[model samples]
Target: MNTAEVLVESLEREGVECVFGIPGEETEALLFALRDSEVTFVPTRHEQGAAFMADVHGRLTGTAGVCLSTLGPGATNLLTGVADANLDKAPLVAITGQGGLERLHKESHQALDVVDMFEPVTKWNAQISDPDIVHESVRKAFKVAEYEKPGATHVELPEDVASEECDVRPLDRRERVRRPDPDEPSIDAVRELLADADRPICIAGNGAVRTDASAALRALASDYDLPVAATYMGKGAVSDADDHSLLTLDSGDHEEASDAIQSADLVVTVGYDIAEHDPADWNPSGETTIVHLDSDPAEVYEHYNPDVEVVADIAAAVRELNACCADLDAEFETDWYDDVRDHIVADVTPEINAGDPFTHRGVVTVLRDAMADDDVLVSDVGTHKMVIAQNFRTFEPNTCIVSNGLASMGISVPGGLAADLAVDSNVVAATGDGGFMMNAAEIETATRLDCGYTILLFRDDEYRLIADEQTDHRGEHFGTEFSNPDFQTFAESFGIEAYRPDGWDELRDDLEAAVESDEMAVVEVVLG
Candidate 1:
């Protein structure tokens, strides 16, 4: 069998059912092999879209989603998406075709240092120069993709290697990857710390969510009357409506949550990577005892110094904490709960009102009002994402999707399209003008894929989120201004229906119609 055949077989075995990419000379062998197999190749208009789709697929499936593209520009286009996957710790595999072996270091046509370019952005990277090592490399890539704090893996295939024959050796399929066990002393130490604390709080991040530790988190929080706070990607890990659960922190109300955290005696951080949290607002210090639980040992001591570092699976660690805290009789603090509730009312309630024309708050309200309870929301990076997290509430988990850890600009459209396929729920993408233009070409992919998702474009004259912050705080607004294209016209060029809402009334009306429309629609709201 050819190396391409073996690679395809291995991919299918690893539960990779779909691949998104465009055709190129280097990928001809793999494409032919994929066609012969059960794996579906979703041809997208651009390599960037392919990478974006792979990201969305990975987020939805909890498996390594694969994207393929050819050499040079194809590889370069996939970088932003792959970097997004890496930052968010999404399980993705980017397979790029490199120029023929004869062209290496010769500056051949369409040739560049593909592996070197992708190295910094990926968890693991390798070029399949030897056909015999392809299986081992594929296995390694998948392993790294699914490992603790998952990220992207890049595998480059040369033209000759794809065409060369290789032994089709079957690899062993393990039920699950073995994670580090929590040292008994560490668990006992944490148990003691929690037992004595009067007011304890748990901070769960995307790492905890990815590790599927929600049930244990809920139990532990409820047992100890602990208030729960999730970072952006960690939203929906605990139900937002739960009495003990607090939604993603509102920057507008940072002082409120900050006050609560400061007063708390015990802080249990589960898979909480401080990288995703805002350093400007959050600080867990002083007399607070931090018991950190993480799947990755490396991430434990980076930000907060933990009194007890439990390097176990997030679920297992939470389960242990629940067991340890189950017997403790904790008194209820109505005053604390009341304070948090008041903060929610003061900080969050006002934004929900039908807001000012062209403001971020207004755009989110229009979307929240338009979507059904079962509908799904995908947000792009920048101010819109933070606003969406703080304002919008989902009925179920995985309903609100965003590249939280990575905070990639061009993620919403592809993620929205993926959400359209993964769930029968109505899909909507909320993106800024700068973010919209980044991967705006994917509007066609949404149309061609027949994804009837709504693209809500916030057409502010510039990158107001950064520019406003810079101007107001730094006395500078350099390189943050942007002139935007008519998103409606751009969407129309893709043969997709487009809507331009010049005012609040038009926005509300057009948004409602777009949601119920038969095809994908980009509702462009011109902001003041």
Candidate 2:
């Protein structure tokens, strides 16, 4: 069998149904292999969009998402998005084509030091130089990408390796690799810690969400009457509508969350990835007994040194903890109820209504009014994401998607694109002017792909948060302000409808119309 054919078989075995990428000369064999298989390859306009789509696919599905790229610039373009997955701890397999080893030392025309370039970002990076090792490499790459503390993994295929013939036998997928499950002693220790504490808090991270432990997480938290504070990636793992729900802590501004974390005598951190949260110095104070649980053993000591480290599948560990903790009658903290409330009150960064009457709250209110209960809203990183994090409330879990960890700028458009593709529910993206320009190319993609959605651009003519932070720090202006093209005109350039809202009422009307419209629409709110 051909190496490409065996590679495609392994991908299908891993349940990779959708691949987002653009074809190139180097990856032609892999592309042909994918075509021969049951998998559907989604050809995107740009490699960046492909990576973003793959990222969201992995995020929504527990499976590792795959994105393919060609040699040189094609592979290089994926670095930003690959870095996003690595930093954000998203499950992604980024496959790229490479020149053969003989061309490596010659400084070949399209050759670059791809392995070194991706080393800093990917959790594991490898190139398949020998046809004999290609099958095993593909299997290893998938496992690394999907395992605990999941991040991007790369597999570079040399042109010769892709075209080579081999008597390849697919590796035994079941026995490839196994993550360490929490031992009996470790489980009992955590249960004992949770059972003894009067006021306990759980900080769930990307690990919890990736492990699909939400049900177990909810059961355990509710049993103990624990108020849970989700890091950015952990948002909506438990419903915010729950009575014991605590607001998501902005990792960037963790003043009150830190205070809450310090106040607790026992902190049960399930799948808590410090990469998703700063946790200020990456360690908890000595006063608190921390029970650290995750699937990746490598993550246990890098940040917080826990009193007890339980390495296991997050869902299994949480489920086991729930079973053990269920027998104990733990006292719920009456005082801790007020602690989360006070933090929510203090964390507000009030924006003055000195600019446009279309306030941030007004925008959310209009969106809430028009959107269905299950309709999903994806937001990019900016002042808008924070505003939505604090203000825009979701009726259910997984309804709100934000770039909490990486906090990348160009994510909104591509995130919106993925949401549209992943679900039939109405999708919308809230982005700032600076972030909107980053992936503005997707406006045409949205129209071409018929991803009927709404785009709201907060046009303040400057990075509003940077401007605000500069005013706080330097007290004098620097290079924060810049001129921008009219986004409404730009949206029209993509053949998408554009709406210019002069005031709050007009914005409300436009949002309502955009929701019901068959085509993609952009509503630009001009902020003074």
Clashes of each: 0, 0
- Cα error, residue 254 of model 2, in Å, equals 9.6
Q: Cα deviation in Å at residue 359, candidate 2?
A: 3.6
**Residues 389-507, model 1: lDDT tens digits:** 87675445566778876677878887787777767768888898888887777777777777888888877767778887888888989787768676667788888888987667778
Model 1, which residues run further than 4 Å from truth? 170-172, 251-254, 278-280, 284-287, 298-303, 332-334, 351-355, 372-374, 474-476, 502-506, 516-518
User: In model 2, which residue pairs have backbone atoms overlapping below 3 Å?
Assistant: none
Model 1 clashing residue pairs (backbone): none
Decoy 1 TM-score against native: 0.92
- CA lDDT of each candidate? 0.78, 0.76
* Model 2: residue 229 alpha-carbon error in angstroms: 1.1
Highest-lDDT candidate:
1
Q: Which candidate comes out best when scored by TM-score? A: 1
Off by over 4 Å in 2: 32-37, 169-181, 250-257, 281-286, 297-303, 342-356, 516-518
Q: Model 2, 1-528: lDDT tens per residue?
A: 777777888888777887888899888888999988999887877888788777776676656778889989999988777888777777889999988777888867889989889999898999887888877887888788876667799999888888889777677566424465569998778778877787778887777776678888998878767877777667767776676666576422555656677777777887777666766542444446788878764254434667788888788888887776666756668576575656564444333342456666557756777888777788887777777876565555566777766677888787788778777788888898898888878777667677888888888888878878888888866787889997777888888899997776677789999977767989888764
